[model samples]
Target: MTQTEAAPVTAAPVDAETYAQIVQFYSHHMQLLDNAEAEEWADGFTEDGVFAQNVKPEPTRGRDTIAASMRRGVDRLKGRDVVRRHWLSMVVADRVDADSVRTKYYAVVFETPAGGKASVYLSTTGEDTLVREDGRWRIRHRLINHDGA
Candidate 1:
Protein backbone atom coordinates (compact mmCIF):
# COMPACT_ATOMS: atom_id res chain seq x y z
CA MET A 1 0.00 0.00 0.00
CA THR A 2 1.19 3.49 -0.84
CA GLN A 3 -0.05 6.90 0.31
CA THR A 4 0.41 10.13 -1.62
CA GLU A 5 -0.35 13.71 -0.52
CA ALA A 6 -3.03 15.50 -2.49
CA ALA A 7 -2.32 18.73 -4.37
CA PRO A 8 -3.08 21.99 -2.65
CA VAL A 9 -6.47 23.41 -3.62
CA THR A 10 -7.68 26.98 -3.37
CA ALA A 11 -10.84 28.01 -1.51
CA ALA A 12 -14.10 28.24 -3.39
CA PRO A 13 -14.41 31.65 -4.97
CA VAL A 14 -16.65 33.96 -2.95
CA ASP A 15 -19.32 36.13 -4.51
CA ALA A 16 -18.07 39.21 -2.67
CA GLU A 17 -15.19 39.98 -5.03
CA THR A 18 -17.35 39.64 -8.09
CA TYR A 19 -20.08 41.71 -6.46
CA ALA A 20 -17.57 44.41 -5.72
CA GLN A 21 -16.61 44.53 -9.37
CA ILE A 22 -20.23 44.91 -10.35
CA VAL A 23 -20.65 47.72 -7.83
CA GLN A 24 -17.62 49.50 -9.23
CA PHE A 25 -18.99 49.10 -12.73
CA TYR A 26 -22.29 50.60 -11.61
CA SER A 27 -20.49 53.57 -10.12
CA HIS A 28 -18.64 54.14 -13.36
CA HIS A 29 -21.90 53.80 -15.24
CA MET A 30 -23.53 56.44 -13.08
CA GLN A 31 -20.66 58.80 -13.78
CA LEU A 32 -20.94 58.26 -17.51
CA LEU A 33 -24.67 58.93 -17.50
CA ASP A 34 -24.29 62.00 -15.32
CA ASN A 35 -21.85 63.37 -17.88
CA ALA A 36 -24.40 62.67 -20.62
CA GLU A 37 -22.10 60.14 -22.21
CA ALA A 38 -24.86 57.97 -23.60
CA GLU A 39 -22.70 56.08 -26.06
CA GLU A 40 -20.25 55.18 -23.37
CA TRP A 41 -22.99 54.14 -21.01
CA ALA A 42 -24.54 51.91 -23.62
CA ASP A 43 -21.22 50.19 -24.07
CA GLY A 44 -21.70 48.58 -20.66
CA PHE A 45 -24.15 46.04 -21.98
CA THR A 46 -23.74 43.03 -24.22
CA GLU A 47 -24.68 43.03 -27.91
CA ASP A 48 -28.00 41.28 -27.32
CA GLY A 49 -28.62 42.53 -23.81
CA VAL A 50 -31.39 44.85 -22.69
CA PHE A 51 -31.98 48.05 -20.73
CA ALA A 52 -35.39 48.47 -19.26
CA GLN A 53 -36.44 51.90 -18.07
CA ASN A 54 -39.74 50.55 -16.85
CA VAL A 55 -40.68 47.13 -15.64
CA LYS A 56 -44.05 47.01 -17.40
CA PRO A 57 -42.67 47.47 -20.89
CA GLU A 58 -40.23 45.35 -22.80
CA PRO A 59 -36.62 46.33 -22.45
CA THR A 60 -34.71 48.30 -25.04
CA ARG A 61 -32.68 45.57 -26.67
CA GLY A 62 -29.24 45.89 -28.24
CA ARG A 63 -26.75 48.71 -27.92
CA ASP A 64 -28.42 50.63 -30.73
CA THR A 65 -31.80 50.68 -29.07
CA ILE A 66 -30.36 51.64 -25.74
CA ALA A 67 -28.27 54.38 -27.34
CA ALA A 68 -31.23 55.72 -29.23
CA SER A 69 -33.32 55.90 -26.07
CA MET A 70 -30.53 57.77 -24.35
CA ARG A 71 -30.17 60.11 -27.32
CA ARG A 72 -33.84 60.96 -27.25
CA GLY A 73 -33.65 61.80 -23.56
CA VAL A 74 -30.53 63.90 -24.09
CA ASP A 75 -32.01 65.72 -27.07
CA ARG A 76 -35.12 66.59 -25.12
CA LEU A 77 -33.02 68.51 -22.62
CA LYS A 78 -30.70 70.11 -25.18
CA GLY A 79 -30.97 73.89 -24.87
CA ARG A 80 -32.16 74.17 -21.34
CA ASP A 81 -29.34 72.83 -19.26
CA VAL A 82 -30.23 70.11 -16.79
CA VAL A 83 -28.02 68.07 -14.55
CA ARG A 84 -29.07 64.58 -13.59
CA ARG A 85 -27.69 62.38 -10.89
CA HIS A 86 -28.32 58.75 -10.14
CA TRP A 87 -27.85 57.63 -6.55
CA LEU A 88 -27.55 53.88 -6.40
CA SER A 89 -27.28 51.91 -3.21
CA MET A 90 -27.93 48.58 -1.49
CA VAL A 91 -26.60 46.52 -4.35
CA VAL A 92 -27.17 42.81 -3.80
CA ALA A 93 -25.52 40.42 -6.21
CA ASP A 94 -25.84 36.64 -6.08
CA ARG A 95 -23.97 34.12 -8.13
CA VAL A 96 -26.66 32.24 -9.97
CA ASP A 97 -24.16 30.01 -11.69
CA ALA A 98 -20.50 29.87 -12.60
CA ASP A 99 -20.93 32.49 -15.31
CA SER A 100 -24.14 34.24 -14.32
CA VAL A 101 -24.98 36.69 -11.56
CA ARG A 102 -28.08 38.49 -10.37
CA THR A 103 -28.11 41.85 -8.63
CA LYS A 104 -30.65 44.19 -7.11
CA TYR A 105 -30.22 47.85 -6.27
CA TYR A 106 -32.11 51.01 -5.58
CA ALA A 107 -31.67 54.18 -7.63
CA VAL A 108 -32.68 57.70 -6.81
CA VAL A 109 -32.45 60.30 -9.55
CA PHE A 110 -32.35 64.00 -8.85
CA GLU A 111 -32.47 66.68 -11.49
CA THR A 112 -31.87 70.37 -11.27
CA PRO A 113 -32.97 72.95 -13.77
CA ALA A 114 -30.48 75.20 -15.55
CA GLY A 115 -31.54 78.26 -13.57
CA GLY A 116 -31.61 76.24 -10.37
CA LYS A 117 -35.16 77.38 -9.79
CA ALA A 118 -36.66 73.98 -9.15
CA SER A 119 -35.58 70.41 -8.66
CA VAL A 120 -37.30 67.27 -9.76
CA TYR A 121 -36.90 63.79 -8.35
CA LEU A 122 -37.58 60.25 -9.48
CA SER A 123 -36.69 57.06 -7.70
CA THR A 124 -36.61 53.48 -8.82
CA THR A 125 -35.27 50.12 -7.78
CA GLY A 126 -33.92 47.58 -10.22
CA GLU A 127 -32.99 43.96 -10.66
CA ASP A 128 -30.05 43.24 -12.91
CA THR A 129 -28.84 39.98 -14.40
CA LEU A 130 -25.28 39.81 -15.64
CA VAL A 131 -23.28 37.22 -17.50
CA ARG A 132 -19.61 36.62 -17.90
CA GLU A 133 -18.68 36.36 -21.54
CA ASP A 134 -15.15 35.88 -22.83
CA GLY A 135 -13.84 36.55 -19.35
CA ARG A 136 -15.65 39.87 -19.06
CA TRP A 137 -18.90 40.71 -17.34
CA ARG A 138 -21.68 42.49 -19.18
CA ILE A 139 -25.24 43.32 -18.18
CA ARG A 140 -27.63 40.86 -19.77
CA HIS A 141 -30.96 42.12 -18.44
CA ARG A 142 -32.22 45.04 -16.34
CA LEU A 143 -35.65 45.65 -14.90
CA ILE A 144 -36.41 48.96 -13.25
CA ASN A 145 -39.27 49.23 -10.83
CA HIS A 146 -40.24 52.82 -10.26
CA ASP A 147 -41.25 53.77 -6.76
CA GLY A 148 -43.28 56.84 -7.55
CA ALA A 149 -45.70 58.42 -9.97
Candidate 2:
Protein backbone atom coordinates (compact mmCIF):
# COMPACT_ATOMS: atom_id res chain seq x y z
CA MET A 1 0.00 0.00 0.00
CA THR A 2 3.07 2.28 -0.06
CA GLN A 3 2.78 5.33 -2.34
CA THR A 4 6.20 4.66 -3.84
CA GLU A 5 5.30 1.04 -4.57
CA ALA A 6 2.19 2.19 -6.45
CA ALA A 7 3.22 3.24 -9.95
CA PRO A 8 0.16 5.50 -10.24
CA VAL A 9 -1.78 3.51 -12.84
CA THR A 10 -2.71 5.82 -15.67
CA ALA A 11 -4.47 3.40 -18.00
CA ALA A 12 -6.86 0.79 -16.72
CA PRO A 13 -6.52 -2.76 -17.94
CA VAL A 14 -9.54 -3.85 -19.98
CA ASP A 15 -11.54 -6.60 -18.35
CA ALA A 16 -11.95 -10.02 -19.94
CA GLU A 17 -15.65 -9.58 -20.78
CA THR A 18 -15.13 -6.20 -22.37
CA TYR A 19 -12.07 -7.51 -24.15
CA ALA A 20 -14.05 -10.40 -25.60
CA GLN A 21 -16.78 -8.08 -26.83
CA ILE A 22 -14.22 -5.92 -28.59
CA VAL A 23 -12.73 -8.97 -30.26
CA GLN A 24 -16.19 -10.15 -31.29
CA PHE A 25 -17.04 -6.78 -32.77
CA TYR A 26 -13.88 -6.79 -34.83
CA SER A 27 -14.46 -10.36 -35.98
CA HIS A 28 -17.99 -9.46 -36.98
CA HIS A 29 -16.72 -6.62 -39.12
CA MET A 30 -14.30 -8.93 -40.88
CA GLN A 31 -17.05 -11.49 -41.42
CA LEU A 32 -19.38 -8.90 -42.90
CA LEU A 33 -16.76 -7.73 -45.35
CA ASP A 34 -15.74 -11.28 -46.26
CA ASN A 35 -19.35 -12.21 -46.92
CA ALA A 36 -19.80 -9.05 -48.97
CA GLU A 37 -22.47 -7.88 -46.58
CA ALA A 38 -21.77 -4.23 -47.18
CA GLU A 39 -24.74 -2.82 -45.36
CA GLU A 40 -24.11 -5.01 -42.38
CA TRP A 41 -20.52 -3.89 -42.29
CA ALA A 42 -21.46 -0.24 -42.39
CA ASP A 43 -24.02 -0.78 -39.64
CA GLY A 44 -21.20 -1.64 -37.27
CA PHE A 45 -20.22 2.03 -37.07
CA THR A 46 -21.91 4.92 -35.37
CA GLU A 47 -24.20 7.22 -37.32
CA ASP A 48 -21.36 9.63 -38.11
CA GLY A 49 -18.44 7.31 -37.64
CA VAL A 50 -15.98 6.46 -40.38
CA PHE A 51 -14.20 3.53 -41.95
CA ALA A 52 -10.92 4.41 -43.56
CA GLN A 53 -8.19 2.47 -45.22
CA ASN A 54 -4.91 4.24 -44.89
CA VAL A 55 -3.79 2.96 -48.26
CA LYS A 56 -6.68 4.86 -49.82
CA PRO A 57 -6.44 8.62 -50.08
CA GLU A 58 -9.98 9.19 -48.81
CA PRO A 59 -11.97 7.74 -45.99
CA THR A 60 -15.58 6.56 -46.15
CA ARG A 61 -18.01 8.31 -43.86
CA GLY A 62 -21.68 8.02 -42.94
CA ARG A 63 -23.67 4.85 -43.31
CA ASP A 64 -24.91 5.27 -46.85
CA THR A 65 -21.59 6.29 -48.31
CA ILE A 66 -19.72 3.62 -46.42
CA ALA A 67 -22.14 0.98 -47.60
CA ALA A 68 -21.91 2.16 -51.16
CA SER A 69 -18.13 2.22 -51.14
CA MET A 70 -18.01 -1.25 -49.65
CA ARG A 71 -20.61 -2.46 -52.11
CA ARG A 72 -18.45 -1.37 -54.98
CA GLY A 73 -15.50 -3.29 -53.61
CA VAL A 74 -17.61 -6.25 -52.67
CA ASP A 75 -19.18 -6.30 -56.11
CA ARG A 76 -15.75 -6.84 -57.59
CA LEU A 77 -15.35 -10.04 -55.59
CA LYS A 78 -18.99 -11.07 -55.39
CA GLY A 79 -18.87 -13.52 -58.25
CA ARG A 80 -15.92 -15.32 -56.82
CA ASP A 81 -17.92 -16.53 -53.80
CA VAL A 82 -14.83 -16.16 -51.67
CA VAL A 83 -14.74 -16.65 -47.94
CA ARG A 84 -12.20 -14.96 -45.67
CA ARG A 85 -11.30 -16.14 -42.24
CA HIS A 86 -9.78 -13.66 -39.83
CA TRP A 87 -7.05 -14.65 -37.43
CA LEU A 88 -6.98 -12.33 -34.41
CA SER A 89 -4.35 -12.69 -31.77
CA MET A 90 -1.90 -10.75 -29.58
CA VAL A 91 -4.61 -8.32 -28.52
CA VAL A 92 -3.73 -5.25 -26.50
CA ALA A 93 -6.38 -2.98 -25.05
CA ASP A 94 -6.12 0.46 -23.48
CA ARG A 95 -9.02 1.92 -21.58
CA VAL A 96 -10.06 5.36 -22.72
CA ASP A 97 -12.72 5.53 -20.04
CA ALA A 98 -14.96 3.20 -18.11
CA ASP A 99 -17.16 2.67 -21.12
CA SER A 100 -14.67 3.35 -23.88
CA VAL A 101 -11.67 1.26 -24.83
CA ARG A 102 -9.11 1.21 -27.63
CA THR A 103 -7.86 -2.18 -28.71
CA LYS A 104 -5.11 -3.15 -31.12
CA TYR A 105 -4.62 -6.65 -32.44
CA TYR A 106 -2.72 -8.52 -35.11
CA ALA A 107 -4.90 -9.96 -37.86
CA VAL A 108 -4.50 -11.94 -41.04
CA VAL A 109 -7.14 -12.83 -43.64
CA PHE A 110 -7.19 -16.14 -45.50
CA GLU A 111 -9.24 -16.20 -48.65
CA THR A 112 -10.96 -19.42 -49.71
CA PRO A 113 -12.62 -19.80 -53.05
CA ALA A 114 -15.90 -21.63 -53.40
CA GLY A 115 -15.40 -25.36 -54.14
CA GLY A 116 -11.68 -24.75 -53.95
CA LYS A 117 -9.48 -26.64 -51.58
CA ALA A 118 -6.63 -24.16 -51.36
CA SER A 119 -6.60 -20.83 -49.57
CA VAL A 120 -4.73 -17.70 -50.49
CA TYR A 121 -3.50 -14.78 -48.46
CA LEU A 122 -5.64 -11.71 -48.84
CA SER A 123 -4.63 -9.01 -46.35
CA THR A 124 -3.06 -8.32 -43.01
CA THR A 125 -3.81 -5.39 -40.88
CA GLY A 126 -1.86 -2.86 -39.20
CA GLU A 127 -4.88 -2.48 -36.70
CA ASP A 128 -8.51 -1.53 -35.98
CA THR A 129 -10.54 0.45 -33.46
CA LEU A 130 -13.78 -0.39 -31.63
CA VAL A 131 -16.20 1.55 -29.48
CA ARG A 132 -18.98 0.73 -27.06
CA GLU A 133 -22.33 2.16 -28.10
CA ASP A 134 -25.81 1.48 -26.76
CA GLY A 135 -24.16 -0.88 -24.30
CA ARG A 136 -22.99 -2.93 -27.27
CA TRP A 137 -19.53 -3.00 -28.74
CA ARG A 138 -19.12 -1.98 -32.39
CA ILE A 139 -16.39 -0.81 -34.71
CA ARG A 140 -16.45 2.96 -34.78
CA HIS A 141 -13.39 3.38 -36.90
CA ARG A 142 -11.08 1.08 -38.78
CA LEU A 143 -7.76 2.26 -40.13
CA ILE A 144 -6.53 -0.79 -41.94
CA ASN A 145 -2.93 -0.26 -42.95
CA HIS A 146 -1.97 -3.39 -44.81
CA ASP A 147 1.70 -4.22 -45.04
CA GLY A 148 1.64 -7.20 -47.42
CA ALA A 149 2.56 -6.15 -50.87
Best by TM-score: 1
TM-score per candidate: 0.81, 0.79
Candidate 2 lDDT tens digits, 82-113: 77676766677777666666666677777778
Please report, in order, the local distance difference test score of every candidate based on alpha carbons. Answer: 0.77, 0.71
How well is each residue in 1-149 modelled by candidate 1, as lDDT tens digits? 13352211222332677867888889998898888788888887888888877544576889878888887777776666888888788876776678877777899888888778545478898878788887767888988888864
lDDT, candidate 2, residue 9?
32
The deviation in Å at residue 139 for candidate 2 is: 2.3
Clashing pairs in 2: none
Deviation (Å) of 71 in candidate 2: 1.7
Question: C-alpha displacement of 120 in model 2, angstroms?
Answer: 3.7
Runs in model 1 lying further than 4 Å from the true structure = 1-14, 115-120
By lDDT, the best candidate is 1
- Clash count, one per candidate: 0, 0
